[model samples]
Target: MILILFFCFSFTVDQYIENGRPSADPVVVNPVMEEFDPTKKPEFIIKPRKQFADEGKVAKFKTSFEGVAQVNWERHGQLLQQNDKYKMYPALDFHYLEISSVTAEDAGSYTCIVSNDVGSDTASAVLEVFETFKPSPTPAPKKLELDVKLLDRDVLEGTQQVEFKCKFSNATTVYWLKDGRKLTENERRKMTFDGVFAMLIIKDISCLDIACYECVATSKRGEEVRTSCALTVKRDKQDCNDETGERSKAPEIVSVTPSDLSVKSGEAAMFTVNHTGDTEVKWYRGRREVEPDDRLIIDNKSGVGHFTIQNALPTDQGVYNVIVTNKWGNDSMLVRLHVEDTSIFDGRDVKISTENFEDFYILQDKVGKGRFGTVHKCIEKSSNRLWAAKIIKCKEKQKPDVRNEINIMNGLTHSKVLRLWDAYESPTGFIIVTEFVCGGELFERIVDDDFVLTESDCAHFMHQICEGVCYLHAKNIIHLDLKPENILCIAKSNNLIKIIDFGLARCLQPGDSIKVLFGTPDFIAPEVVNYDEISYATDLWSLGVICYVLLSGWAPFTGETDSETLVNVTQAKYDFDEDIFEDISELAKDFIQKLLVKNKDHRMTIQDCLKHEWLALDTVDGQIMKRLSTDKLKTFIARRKWQVPTPASSLKQSNGGGPSGKAFLNGGADHWHHSHHHRKGHMQTPRSSSYSNGQVPWKKNGNAIQAVNRMIGKFSSLSSNSSISSSSSSSPTSSSSLYSKSKQSS
Candidate 1:
């Protein structure tokens, strides 16, 4: 045996050297473990201690769960791990313990045995599989919503079904809590319910139930998983007294409203504020104290506090904050107030006025005072009609300029001049609603009709004006401003002219001289230079200037410099272009020269113009130039209005110009008669109401006033005719002849 051991030791040294292992001092192993003792009994015991591992991946922890108990893994109550849990005989020794294919089921109580040649012992251990995924934590409210509409509802209102869902995802189950108590405790009838979420069925919840409400969700593992809300149940039964008794003693703000935004510096701002939960409600501005007046004002009148800021100054322009203090807490809200300068208006600046465009359109403002109001387009709501509303800015210290314009327009019943329909006043300003001419201004038509005009075209346009203005002059009204832009062409109509912008017009007595300087600079008459005195002849001078521009297609005396032009006008000197003279005639020039004299006294009277050569029955190259074919004139008006003249119309065009067999192309005889009668009336504006006194009192209060004055004017004219009839029997025949001529032409 000794000789065999020595040979074995030498062989072990040679093997270690071949394997390249560092040599160590000879150390004894648990020598019995190196070889199997076939004749002796052996035992197996699980190594280490009890084991734990994740259920899903537990098999990776160990092959057969090497633990003190030598557990045999089991799954679904069946053995799966490579371990002999079903049968293991320790008396028959086994040295190599091996296992294959482990599973979570392998984790369980197991036994191991240790045996020697004489006896064997056993040890047991238990292995457990824990979860990697933990139970969710309890969560907070994800949403916070207020039920402000509750205040408008009746008491004992059943719960508006609401769903409180927890977003604690990955959690197996969710738990709900509310107001420091778990909502899991469902009440008998009016219970807090749980389906997909937690809900409180507020059965007959009154004001007493009003409180801060929220929710939270927890997982099965006692973890919060979701958020809730800060719910407020504004109970219906809650009042100031009841709220004070049931809840904390804090003040609360209610609703507030103000009377006006504008007040005098020393005036008061009236307001009302509603409150609850406060013993007393007070008001303030910034840091300054402002108190409510009334020694007998109740402290609990609907919980509303009425306040007035007396003698409010400019410094009170900031926020007016009101604080209500109750036993619970404080509540406040801020309001803004403004003070204005009250000296801008006088009481008389405004009047109750109506617009007759559409069934009496009515409004109130500084009608004629604002800059933009100087030119306003008003729509008569009733009729869906459009009207031009002109305002004269006659602020403090300025004479009522609008009165002057209206007086001039009202006096003149002229087709060329815009018709004065009505006048009104309001705190804002004075307003005049005149005839709406959809045709636009004359300058605008010049571009629309294309450049330059033929002599016949000029004659037609200027002749219409002569007729309208002559009617005005017959009533002793002067169109102080007669610029071409003031002349508007009727939209989709004949050669009708609607003169507008009477902002500088004036009415005069026969031979009366207006000593005011106002008119378009280019159109002003020489005699109006000083505004010292100007008569009907001054208008004649401007008329002469107007006709020259129309006939020659340019002003007769235009200079590069205003000074040069004014000097020429003042000197009564001018010459037409020689080049254009061939295109004009002596008759037209003579007509213009007869009126454009420096001395107002030498200006031609309207009657003198009646028999002028150009207006007389003159033959132009054997053709009657004075007569216009009614059929052709109608076609012309229609053509300009976008109507393509059919071949049928051309047949009538061959017969000169006129309305063909269309009869009257203008307004009916009724309108002509009205004009004829108005032609006889002595017209006046509100500015001359003082002059008329009781005889012709026309006011500018409203549409009713204007209508009344127009009637009175008609009667006055009828009365005046009686005197003319007695003075001259020939006058009636002459008037009838003039009316006949207009009828035939139209």
Candidate 2:
């Protein structure tokens, strides 16, 4: 019964255990375990330190994590990118963030964040980017100070002289003042400054001279310093005597020495007169009273009065009067003083008047024009004589050259050289009045169909040129440019020639080494092209080239281009062409050869050339008297005219109707207009041709001979149809209008 009860209890217990236990299909044992915890949230093993960097440098931030995690970088609370500017490296334990080329904007707080599935750990650091260092600048020196201290003084009335002195330091200018009014230097009052010392002298001081004097000094930096002094005048015995009214005798002139006097400029002149009785003496120039000054002095003592003039000038020439006055009467004497005219330009006696040019002359017609100005035929009003007026526009900078030319021409006196009659200076220009030449240029006569030219005639022309050149050389002057265009005839019927146009002339002193590069290409001397020392012989070379051209109607050194011509001149490359020079005498060729030498020392001088047999009229060979053909000369003149750029209107106005007529006696009316080429500074022979106007054709391989042939062919074809006027006008009709027309076209 008990066993039955136990089984039932056990079954009951089992049923209760089964009902209370968790549901399972089979019985199983569960392993014992603790509560699970995630890996400690990533802890920073090293915190990023603050970084300092300069502009354009690199900055780095690094940190190490205690556990595995993802890493990121942030600046100014913004996530950073791994690009050219920012770079990041993430590893299991180390993390790095790098920045390149740090700038001012890169300075900020940088954060390193490490995160896992649970949480994140972060560290922050500050980045500082500073500008490159630069040192401060030094201070400037202080300005200088000026001291102008003066002393007070007292002087008796009628004192001979009273002076006030002062001193200054580092002052550029100083001025004196009387009672706050500026004091001007005059005859009685004189002001002088030497170095740092200054003085003001008052002569014949009177009661009116009492005043407050001030001196103002100006520093170089424009600062001003000033000081003042008082001047006191005391009563003299002479004033009391005048108030007492003593009886005075009448003044009478006893004798006056030298009633009239004449002196040269810069010379001193004195006049003395004797008078009776006590009197006050005074001197007068014209109607103005003469006072004592640095240049004038007057003294009266012991019944004698003297008036003196120092460093007299032309303006001082006038009538003078001396008067002696007493209480009873006065005596006066009149004297005439004249100061001769002096040289005003470069020690040369060139008198330039400032009066109106129109007052002395009447402009009749416009005859010539050039780059400088215009020329006109004028008639002198007083003499009714014809003269050519060259009106040169004198710019401020160009006045010196014009004045130099005037000085040179004024000193020259020769029959073969053109004469300078007068010169006047105007506000805008200069009017140069010269002798009137009715004839035209030498080449102009050669180009005439009816004109007859012989070797003797050429010799006569050269003789005149040599005479003029010899005269110039005697005065240490060299006419560097000698050409046919510069030779002028006195009249159409006369054989006399005048050498004109001294524009390129120079007055060289002994031992002077001056080199200049300027002249026509065809006539340029070898020394000119070589930049050698120029002497009197340089002009002889040009004369040689002129003779060659006159004989052959072609320039000896002329090539297709100016550069080639220059090269040929430098090498002294020229030959007497048989086609044109066959009839020319051997003596003439010998003269040219002697003068055309490359060495200036070996070149024939003007005096030697004048003695050559070719120039001697008595020794002229029959071959020299032979008539030369004018066809080549006409071709030359036509080619020259064509080469000169001309306006269309110039063709119709060839008969002295154009502005370019024979206006000036000087042959420079077409100076710049006909200049083939004018080069300055150092010269270089070009390997290729450089055509200035684009009218000339380019030559292959710079073949000068081929180019010359082409030019001759081109000009020869047009010579038959070219009817150039051979007027006796010294002006260029085509080139004169060219300058204005070119300006208009531009």
Candidate 3:
């Protein structure tokens, strides 16, 4: 046995030397397992432990055998090196392998071998290496800084082409997002990408095309950038989609031009349309076809047609009609142009007013008629501007007066002063075009639609009037005909007052007085009634009368005849009846009293009117500015009209019958004629009492005034009075008639 052992030891040493293994130690084996023992094969209590570790973590694999055993470790069927990175603990009954700083390179199938005297046992496990480290909360992803921008676009509805584009730098791939979501190929949207641009093409754009679009660009380095913009799609509300597809080709009105447009002279006016399908566009001014010239331009392209008029004039103000025609159908739109008078802006320093009378069309109905001329509503064609065109026949006696009126109008530039746009010579002598105050008379506005006139409203309008008059006074011009009819409201929405009628306006030096009797009877000052000197004080007296009428809706002075009216005016016998003036502020009464004083020198100045305590509503007791019942005032006037005698009979009675009858009627003839004409056209019923522009004398004070106020309450059942007098539009001859007739009759 000893000999056999020596031989085996010698043999082991020789084999170890042949395998090139270090041989500092002797080989040890189990003496009993020198021969194979089938019954005592090795088994394991603990096999290699499966491990999950991070890139820099340590992984351990261990195993223990139960029966008599020897253990060894191998990697990928090859012997493993036992060093600092990989270490193995080998024992008689157990063995373990540990790898520190585990790397992807150290991952593979590792096997453990166990041996007994009879046979060996093997166990294998796989080590999977993932690109990711031990999981942690993900850090914020890096953002791309690529140069990218999206261009915005506007498109019309119906069969239209629309595109969205994005420009980028160094883009690897590009895509689109519609309304915050990824865009894809669909029936309505088509997306494409070029070298550095991304595009979303939409065919047949509709209201649905209105959306925000985004373009996303990604680089080869995995960086991403994006840009976005909104798409505006305008569609015609009336041109709805055909449910049955029957009116597909019909030319429909997309949007009609504004029903009314007010343009200043020498400005441009544009009318535009958008419709579906192919069509031809035609334009007309009144009944005449519009031919394009240097001032008139027509543009029709890509479903849009535009009509523009440059350098618009008073003659350009009128109703314009656009006719759009196609094989399917035809449609039309009307635009009314209201041209503002620019002639008032002309002066020594200003340019000449447009004299093209062809721009304006005169309506047949006359607003006023007198010895001087007739006034008609004229419209400018291109701008839809409205003007009061006064057609005057050339008379040898009226030339200087007309020239003076024009010169005064041309020199004034206050916003509250009526603007005279143009004066043109024609076969009918001359046509003076003035701004059309669409809001009508100030009294008319007060009575409209249950509108309650507050003291603030009064102050507001009064302030404007004072400012305009102040401007006129500074220029040494006096408006002898200032009245409710002459004071026109700028518009219905506002209380802006514009003083009209320069025909009665006379530029006077300070202290200069005109002896020729002028001004309406009711509004004429005491000095004028006494045949005294007429100065700026006369205008103040008229303003006081207007204020009284506005507050109480009754003339301050009224009588059965012009003589009685003149007597009351000359005496300054107007009184504020408490019943009618109960709501009026004491400050307002004071203001009116100051103006209506018998002494013209003591009357309120325009400056004093502006500084009146009544106008200071913001600082005074709020109760004083309470709203007045305009309904009550309108009702009172309606009843007074029925009670008063007919103006025609009164005028005829004042003047004996004459062939000319030129000076045969009293001053009330103009007002009566204008009121009657207005009533015939608008108010078909028994007309309300006409507010005379001439001497309107009230009954002797006290009980008489009380009787009129009481009667007004009972007259509340009458219909709305639609009549508006254009006494402010009278000619020079009629203007003087008011003063001359009152003086003659008295």
Candidate with top lDDT is 2
Q: Which has the better TM-score: candidate 1, or candidate 2?
A: 2
Tell me the whole-model lDDT of each prediction, alpha carbons only: 0.44, 0.64, 0.60
lDDT of 2 by residue, 226-248 (tens): 87676655542222236657745
Rank order by TM-score, top first? 3, 2, 1
Please provide TM-scores, in order, for all candidate models, with all chains considered together.
Answer: 0.35, 0.42, 0.47
Regions more than 4 Å wrong, model 3: 1-268, 277-372, 377-387, 424-428, 616-620, 624-626, 635-746
| Residue-level lDDT tens digits of model 1 in 588-672 | 7888889888788888886677656665523444433332223322333333234332221211111121111111111110000
Could you tell which candidate, 2 or 3, scores higher by TM-score? 3
Candidate 1, RMSD to the unseen true structure? 32.8
Cα displacement (angstroms), candidate 1, residue 250, comes to 79
Error of 3 at 364 (Å): 8.6
Flag clash pairs in model 2.
367-661
